[model samples]
Target: MTTYIPQLTLPEQVFASAPASILLPVALGTTVGYSTRPKQTKETYNLIRQPPLRPPPWVFGPVWTVLYGLTGYGAYRGIGLNLTSILPGTMSVARRAATLYTVQLGLNLAWMPLFFGARRPAAAMLDVLALLGANAYLACLFFGTRDGLADPVAGWCWAPYLAWLSFAAYLNAGVGYLNGWDISDATLRRRKAVGKGAQ
Candidate 1:
């Protein structure tokens, strides 16, 4: 006797298979960061001494747009892999990897507000460092070898992000150093007021 299996509808299959749930929120958060671009550009220009390797201000938007797309796609692919896995152990590992991805994404989202909105390079440097750490951890999770469940595509997808963050850490440190970033809130407010007056 043959056992009958229920077939999934197209929408159900797509809903179950696709990673939109994970990617959409990430894309939304990234979009929100664009609102801070003008402030970031102004602050960057006003820097007394930018790092030697700093890219043109215009480069950031395009670069991050590409990077965020890659990141979201990588995450979507990773989650797809997880969702289709058969074993409970595999599912657990995938869930852990997804969680790490979320943590790093949160760090990514926090950096803009700290750096541009608050104009606190020192604090932002700390956030960037933490972001670097999270990226590293997530990369390791994606490339884990001992279990033979490594997702090389997902792991390699983080390469550009990790490289960018390394450069950003250097730039953040340079900005913090050159600007003496330990100033008070009042000083920051006064500087912003003065900057607005000049513009």
Candidate 2:
């Protein structure tokens, strides 16, 4: 009997092998995204009419920290599988998945700014919808059953993120409905005016 291990491509050897390196950028990206919001945004967020199901504000930080870590690990695993696969066409599928993942991350980062910093829940909801779509596509790619790659572990890894996004979509929709602002460019301006008047 003979055992064979697929050789890692140069890129994989340099990048995919170290999960920590992949996770480092994810953590930093999330930190930068969070920092984009003004300090006043937190005060505004706390004052908003959140849905009854909304978790306390403190919950978000811990949840997101765990989610970011899991997502980074999942990405690392998916990329490693693709890079080291002996199977033809695996890398292409993985590349597509990675791209979608990147796009969703961007969308994720954009939501906080749109909702809290810019005070535009409507715009944030749009970003959330796009994020949901990208996340679903990425999850399917990892599951690979339909696509024939079959990496259940990687697929499961994305479960938390998907769940969180779904909850967030509900929250975003609730906020938009409660605030009476959706797709209206004037909403932010109106909010600013009201904030100024109150001050």
Candidate 3:
């Protein structure tokens, strides 16, 4: 049997293409997008109406920073390794895991649009519930694959997202209660006040 030898030289993209690295940029860009949806200046209330127990806006930065880094890498490694191992058409555990990952990512991206873009808290809640289901699906797929490395890592990556959305869901529900379906009129007044205050 020949001993496998390690090559000191590998493709640059191996490191460059790392999933973890992708997370920082996507997250940073997403951050910008997320922030832009808020008031024009000064500040409005926290993104949602909640008791003071709610986390500060600053907390989200640190929390998502860690979570996104882990998420991008875990997802990248899981799908990357598995996809490279087999044909796309193969019915294997890796393929299954990869598919679930894609679904979850799609749901994750949808939250911003449904909430901020459309300002539909009710619709956003529904989307988040679906997001929850997708995360559960991904977790189960990861655990069942028995791949050792991917399962727990993948599951762990999803936990914070689950927690954040859970909080957001509650906040959305409460705000919808305190406000109403169309907060546009109220929100516009608030934004104008905030923008004026900044000046």
Candidate 4:
């Protein structure tokens, strides 16, 4: 008697063979790469932030990890479908959306390096804008792809991404203003409060 190993169909095979963990680093690489600019940037950031907003630093890791998994899977679904007979306009839009999505992720990856590595909040703000723009376009293009069966899942996937980009935009802008304006006085107050256990 021999043990049998079942063969996965093509897409399943791709899904099954691909490790889900790969999404983690790619998602986190965005963070790590962005954070490498200079440690001092984070210092002033901490001083200015003082109390800190945006869901306490500890929460981001788990949240982004889960989000990246969803994002990668959604990407696979949105682009992996056969488009042999789809209209040219839709195809063009879809391709454009896919390109946008790729750019957004690439930008996402680059953002950390710019913000944290180089300590360039202004540059990070620029990158976040691109990410938001690309995601917005992808949402619309994918909207056209929506049908009775696929619309719910595909449309739903982009919602979180849009929300996330929006929040990131705010964060980037806020950081840039605080840093670029050189509000050393305001930062001192917050920094002092932290020392007093005000947070």
Q: Which is the leading candidate under lDDT? A: 2
Overall local distance difference test of candidate 2:
0.68
Expressed as tens digits, the lDDT of each residue in 1-199 for candidate 1 is: 1111222111223213435643454465667666777764465456435668777777876778777766666665554466468976655665555655666677777887787777778888999999898778767766776542377887887799899999999988987776677434565456577763331
Q: Record all residue pairs in model 3 with backbone atoms less than 3 Å apart, i.e. clashing.
A: none
Off by over 4 Å in 3: 1-17, 20-44, 86-91, 145-150, 187-199
Using Cα atoms with residue i matched to residue i, what is each candidate's TM-score against the true structure?
Answer: 0.76, 0.79, 0.67, 0.66
* Candidate 1: residue 94 Cα off by (Å): 1.1
Compared with the true structure, all predictions reach lDDT values of 0.65, 0.68, 0.56, 0.55
Identify the superior model by TM-score, candidate 2 or candidate 3.
2
lDDT of 3 by residue, 1-199 (tens): 1111223212223323565444643665466546656453114344334433566667655665666676666665554455465444322555555545555556666766666666677887787788777666666555454432245666676677677777867776775676554445367467466753331
Number of clashes recorded per candidate: 0, 0, 0, 7
Q: Candidate 4: worst 10 consecutive residues by lDDT? A: 1-10
Candidate 2 lDDT by residue in tens digits, 1-199: 1111222122344227556635664676568656865455555665565677988777887788778777777777775567567766776666556555655677887888787767788888899999888778777778776553467777787899899999999999997887666423354356556862331
Which residue pairs clash within candidate 1?
none
Question: In terms of TM-score, which candidate is stronger, 2 or 4?
Answer: 2
Error of 3 at 177 (Å): 2.4
How well does model 1 score by local distance difference test?
A: 0.65
The residue-level lDDT of candidate 3 at 125 comes to 75
Candidate 1: misplaced stretches above 4 Å? Answer: 1-26, 37-40, 182-199
Model 1 weakest 10-residue run by lDDT: 1-10
Ranking by TM-score, best first?
2, 1, 3, 4
Between candidates 1 and 3, the one scoring higher on TM-score is: 1
